[model samples]
Target: MAIFVHLTSAANAARIRRAGLRADSWARTGERGVYCFPVLPSFTVTHQWLRELARRGTRGGGMVAVHLRLDDDEPVLVGHYAGRGKHAARSATAAEAVHRIRELDDPRGWEVFVPRAVTAGEVRRVRAVPQGVGWRYFPGAHGTRPCTCFGCRVRGEYGGRRLRERLPHPLDGPDPKVPVLLERLAAAGEPGDPKEVAEVLYWFARRRRGPVEALIRLTEHPDARIREDLVWAVGGWRSPGVGELLERLAGDPVAEVREAAAQARSDG
Candidate 1:
């Protein structure tokens, strides 16, 4: 199975920065749909950002990038959420692989597949900005993007308030399995406790849809996990409210929570 991933231009730079990339380091997407941001973005809870792609070049299609450092750890999925089996290994010293990446012919643009789970933590290191956003942005068919690019071009039907509204939730049309899971968790759940809420949200992240909006509306979910999960879900929905919601989540106590919060605001 293969997984698809979409990330904004800003995230691509952040991913490299987070990985401790040096001034000379290079970052690019691989064949799979995974993105290899080294730093991940930073944002304000009150002002979540957006995932903006650059203008189209000659190449246009879903792509991925791999940082094949030789002296990292072992093999890992670059885009876990997409379920795409493509992967990259940095089992050798980082110096070795980084050298190889630079020598690739016409590496500027092509169809390259990478690992499954790509996050900032996975990068080795970078000291300065890499040419990520300038050269890379998640592409869609032709010059369109999976986000508003395609939606606006095709005049597609909006998903409606259910995808954006903060209240009542889209209980009628959300995936059926999620509702069942929510019920099971709710039956055994204790409200007001962030732990319970966090646990429930994690389960929801695995599904396509659930009572994610309801969880976001509740002010009681202080657990960064709960907060991140809610924001992530909302962003996945691509509700216009996504930027605002993610901005609110950036203040989470945990860096992981904050990173996830920043992720939700990407240019999608």
Candidate 2:
């Protein structure tokens, strides 16, 4: 079975599992509510989708469908009728779905299909989609649709905070649970998936606060990507000793690491 992801609300995720994707009552006459886009599976893609989900103003938490199956390559579309109408679309790709929607006299009636729920093991923290393993938003259709749904309207709408500022700093407060996150860092040396390890490093590093030895050690990690991310984290801290660390990393053997250090210095 081909697995896909459908990014939506925690509530909507449950609703879809109970009932298959259907037309939104808010949709105009004869319009189907299901939308789907094909996405290449990768860490960057999954990360981007989670970022988009957070931006859409999902306040507390976000949800993603880990396993989804569609009819062949086409996105499943539902119309006012049982499942037959000009509004229903079956394009081989998200881009084609957009093209099909454009051809319609009016495309407002259509909605995207919400995927069925998987076990809780498949779900993850809104901002913390286990590194290389998470759901991806197929950009083909998402790129074209205005998506007035609560999810779309709030995309990239984090008020004053930037999208990257999801986690709290280690020094944020006594009650912010800093020690728990710190323990995650301490446990990084344990054997595990590289992708997952990279994510943990990123989670702490992105906060850019409270320099720790474990984070510095990660800079020497075999994976250039992890090293690059650590450099970014170090650069973000902008503490008294960070400048020296970045200066050393400025000459890192890996071009990516050196480049990342350079960018971080410039940004800092």
Q: lDDT of each prediction vs. the true structure? A: 0.39, 0.48
Q: Which tens-of-lDDT digit does each residue in 1-268 have in candidate 1?
A: 1211233334345554455322221123322223332211221110111122333211223222333232243332222122233323332222333333335442222222234434454443322222233332322233543333222321123342332333333332343366665675566555446665555655555443344445555423645556666765555553345455566667766776666665555434
lDDT (Cα, 0-100) at 36 in candidate 2: 35
User: Where is model 1 poorest over a 10-residue stretch in terms of lDDT?
Assistant: 42-51
Cα-based lDDT at residue 243, candidate 2: 71
Per-residue lDDT over 160-187 for candidate 2, one digit per residue giving the tens place of the 0 to 100 score: 2432244334343322244665666556
How far in Å is the alpha carbon of 207 misplaced in model 1?
5.6
lDDT of 2 at 102: 42
